[model samples]
Target: MIIPVDQLNPDTLNQVIREFLMRQGEDWGLAEGHLDDAIQQARDALVQGNLVLYWDENEESLTILSKEEVNQSGLG
Candidate 1:
């Protein structure tokens, strides 16, 4: 299930983005240095609808994904 970023509290939204960055491991670029900046970037993506939050109901895991991924996964 996909959750709207707006549906989350500010703190929870930030935590989700941070966790996603950790899991991405530099895949989206430089997950190591300047954590705050990276997180802000992710937040911007979410605000712009370029990124979305996905909840894996069965596994009870949460993740961030691009708009294309959401579409491809039929979660959009």
Candidate 2:
């Protein structure tokens, strides 16, 4: 579910993003710091308007993806 940027509360939204990255770190066998880096990258993408944030009901988590990239990934 894509959330409009204006609809999110920044502090809560960032916490959700951080939690998602930490979970991804565990899934990907990445170390602690790696998750932090990934979260930072996602934020950068959001700032650049290259990505948007959404909630995944299945995973009960937040995710980030570029609109075009997501369409190409066949995951959305």
Candidate 3:
């Protein structure tokens, strides 16, 4: 399911982004202090409609994905 960014609590959204960034840290070579920047970039993408928030009911999990990815996967 597609999750609307405006429908989520700000704190919850930030936490989710934080977790996702932590997982991506290796690939991003993200330093501890640089997390905020990364988060902002992710948030910007979300606001710009370049990224999406997805909720998978079966897995009971949420994931952040690119708009193209969602379209390609037929999840949107």
Candidate 4:
């Protein structure tokens, strides 16, 4: 379920991420500012090289998690 970083195309990844955030906003009924903050956090994680995208087979979804957490869980 965990996808390798090398396997993803960056553009597709970005699009998926954008959609995920938008969906989250709608699902949670978040305000614009709150959604913006969440988006910024995601961007910061990527900038810090602390997060990666993975494909969850069971859920058939993508997720972002800290690198350390991923490694600790033996999912990397």
Top-lDDT candidate index: 3
Pairs that collide in candidate 4 are none
RMSD in order of candidates: 1.5, 4.0, 1.5, 4.3
Please give me the total number of clashing residue pairs in predicted model 1.
Answer: 0
For candidate 3, what is the lDDT? 0.87
The candidate that achieves the highest TM-score relative to the unseen native structure: 3
As a whole number from 0 to 100, the lDDT of residue 26 in candidate 2 is 65
Better of 1 and 4 by TM-score: 1
* Model 3, residue 21: C-alpha shift (Å): 0.8
What value does the lDDT take at residue 1 in candidate 1? 81
Least lDDT summed over 10 consecutive residues: which range in candidate 3? 24-33
Q: Report lDDT (CA) for all predictions.
A: 0.86, 0.69, 0.87, 0.68
Error of 4 at 65 (Å): 1.2
The positional error of residue 29 in candidate 2, measured at the CA in angstroms, is 10
TM for every model, in the order presented, reads: 0.86, 0.55, 0.89, 0.52
The runs of at least 3 residues in candidate 3 whose Cα sits more than 4 Å from the true structure, single-residue gaps closed, are 26-33
Model 3, 1-76: lDDT tens per residue?
9999998999999998888888878644486568888889999989898989999999999988889999999999
Off by over 4 Å in 2: 26-37, 56-61, 66-69, 73-76
Each candidate's number of clashing pairs is 0, 0, 0, 0
